[model samples]
Target: MIGEMKAQQEEIELLLSAFDRLVEIPDEERVVFRTLIERKTIPAQSHFVLIGEPTADIGFCLSGLFRLYYTTPDGIEYNKNFCGKNEFIAAYSSLLMKEPAYFSIQALMDSELLVVPFRNFETLFDRHACWEKLGRKIAEGMFISKERRERELLMLSAEERYRLFLGRYQHLENRIPQYQIAAYLGITPVALSRIRRRLT
Candidate 1:
């Protein structure tokens, strides 16, 4: 029991450190934020959020990997994004609109997350300017990421996208399956293999 408590404490410290990197939080505000957090573990191949389900929390990945994907009517899945340790994941549009999520978030590996209700954060936004700034920054970052992804898909060649993917997710290459990477690049697994050969 003591060991579990100590581990939870360590995770909380890590969460605080991550927040500190983004924006400074006053001790009182930090305490309030801490109270809002819940530690969650998602096993490999399990989902944190599913399509058409309401998601009320935003998760900070403490460890492990996740993929956000959308499925077609025929059940084909298209990879939209990947989240790794120290990253945040949420169905932002769904949360903001108070609707069911359009995409699903699945754990690619056993993952631990620091979860907080979006509503809790919304409350904090009214209490402090720092929280508001943090929220704004997070939103801006998401917007930039979305814009970049769209540009890459529209303007870049498959080979070029593969190169960019390597540069951006080099550490995750071995950890993620090649088929998923191919899906993320919007290419067939065979094409991805050819690209790898051409690069080598």
Candidate 2:
């Protein structure tokens, strides 16, 4: 009763905060956006997006962690990024182009997400100026993040990259498995162990 109401209130606040990261949502539009968004809980190891499948929804993480990864034909998996609480998660390339995703997104823990269907979300771009600005801001943020990651991958040493990873995602270090962290660092588990030993 009271506990459930408090939990719901907390989740609503989190959702609003995430939306505000893109643009300030007007009171009237906020109500409409909240009405359209849906809440989903994904169990550990389940996927939010799958390789070769169209991404129909974009989600904001309410709680828990997700890994965005790509698999080669040989079945080797490489983690591209992790999305944690309050961050947006989407196969954006696929979402924008209406094509199958090249990467997959999976929860590393039981996670709650606030999701909006891409079709419904896209309609807001044309319907409202605020949403249009929000869309552009999201795009610019993604591009900047991508470029920063690219530079780090190309120029940083393995140890340096590990340090950068720690700086960027230290909050996730204890929450997810070491092997996934190793994969994101493009290092073997044994190598990651050595790096950890050296850092400590």
Candidate 3:
């Protein structure tokens, strides 16, 4: 029982540290947020968010990896993004608009997440200036990440995209599958193998 409590405290502190990277949470607010948040365990290959499902909670990954992907009606899947430890993952559009999610969030491995219900979190934006500031900062961060990815995809060659992915997420090279990386780079697996051979 004591060990379980300690583990829970550690998870809370880990998530708090991640939030600190974006905004400083006062002790009182931290306590409140902790109360509002819950810990969830996702097994490998489990889908956190499914296409056409409403996103009710935003997750802060404490451990493991998650991939955001979309599948066409024809069953073609494309990996849009990957979120690893200490990062936030959500179907932002669906969360904000309370609509069906366009993409799915899937666990690449067994993962632990700190999750907060959007309704509870959004209410804090009106209740506290700091929360409002945090929300804006989060949105700005997301926008900047999206814009940078768009530019890279538009201007960079397939090989260049692969190189950029390596430079940015070298740690993930072994953790994620090559096919997913190829999909993210907008290239086929065979093409990715050729690029790797050329670089080597």
Residue range with the least summed lDDT across 10 consecutive positions in model 1: 13-22
The residue ranges of model 1 lying beyond 4 angstroms of the native Cα positions read: none
lDDT of 2 by residue, 1-200 (tens): 99976786678778877668778988888777766777789999999999998789988898899999999999988899899888888999898999999999999999999888989988887767888898788778888888987898898888999999888898888888899998898889999999999999
What are the per-residue Cα lDDT tens digits for candidate 3 across 54-130? 78998989889999998989987888889998898899888888899999999999999989999999988876688
Q: Which is the better candidate, 1 or 2, if ranked by lDDT?
A: 1
Best by lDDT: 1
Q: Give the clashing pairs for model 2.
A: none
Q: Which stretches of candidate 3 lie above 4 Å from their native place?
A: none
Candidate 2 global CA lDDT score: 0.87
Instruction: Tell me the whole-model lDDT of each prediction, alpha carbons only.
Output: 0.92, 0.87, 0.89
Question: Compared with the true structure, what per-residue lDDT tens digits does model 1 show for residues 1-200?
Answer: 99998898898889888878889989999888878899999999999999999899999999999999989999888899999998989999899899999999999999999999999889998899999999887888888999999899899999999999999999989999999999899989999999999999
Q: Estimate each model's TM-score.
A: 0.96, 0.92, 0.96
- Which residue pairs in model 1 clash with each other? none
